[model samples]
Target: MFLGTGGMTPGHQLAERDDRKTAWAWYRGRAVRDLANGYTMKRVYR
Candidate 1:
């Protein structure tokens, strides 16, 4: 799996093989992550 760097024009690419790939981006006052199912992971535990 591959990850992306966040910026004004961040880019990403990924290939999965039974892996939980995720990507995060800042929006409003929340930290959200992307999943393979096209769902935003809005839960932060850190």
Candidate 2:
């Protein structure tokens, strides 16, 4: 049902140019099982 529990956003600012590109690509992946409704879902981004 896509409970939209929790998720991560990968972003950066131009001021933070010192940051590495890999850092922006790293984000938390999430998924859950909902057998009662017979569906699998993942968190949604705002």
Candidate 3:
């Protein structure tokens, strides 16, 4: 979650364009892999 948020945070914009692309790609890939492995979150409303 933090990786996804960090990828889009304002501070990310300060990075070089190439670095931003690489970071975003890495973050996205990690998310996809996790989902493929069945990692999930369930929300509980109380």
Candidate 4:
């Protein structure tokens, strides 16, 4: 799933795979090491 901030701005992306598992944040058009302070994310189990 993809979450956009602005009308046409890039935002966070989440994907699930059996072989790969990790959370990532993106800014502008590049992958970031970490998000800014006060930002947080929670994982939901299905």
What's each prediction's TM-score? 0.12, 0.18, 0.50, 0.12
Cα-based lDDT at residue 2, candidate 1: 35
| Range of the 10 consecutive residues with the lowest summed lDDT in candidate 3 | 37-46
Error of 2 at 21 (Å): 0.9
Per-residue alpha-carbon lDDT of candidate 3 for residues 1-46, written as tens digits (9 for 90 to 100) = 1256755766555566668789999999999988866644423322
The candidate scoring highest on lDDT is 3
* lDDT (tens digit, per residue) of candidate 1 on 1-46: 2344454222332233212233222342153223522343344422
* Alpha carbon lDDT at 17, candidate 4: 42
- TM-score (C-alpha, index-matched) for candidate 3: 0.50
**Each prediction's whole-model lDDT (CA):** 0.32, 0.35, 0.68, 0.34
- Better model by TM-score, 1 or 2? 2
Instruction: Write the residue-wise lDDT of candidate 4 on 1-46 in tens digits.
Output: 4345554333232234421343222242243324422144423321
- Which regions of candidate 1 fall more than 4 Å away from where they truly are? 1-22, 26-46
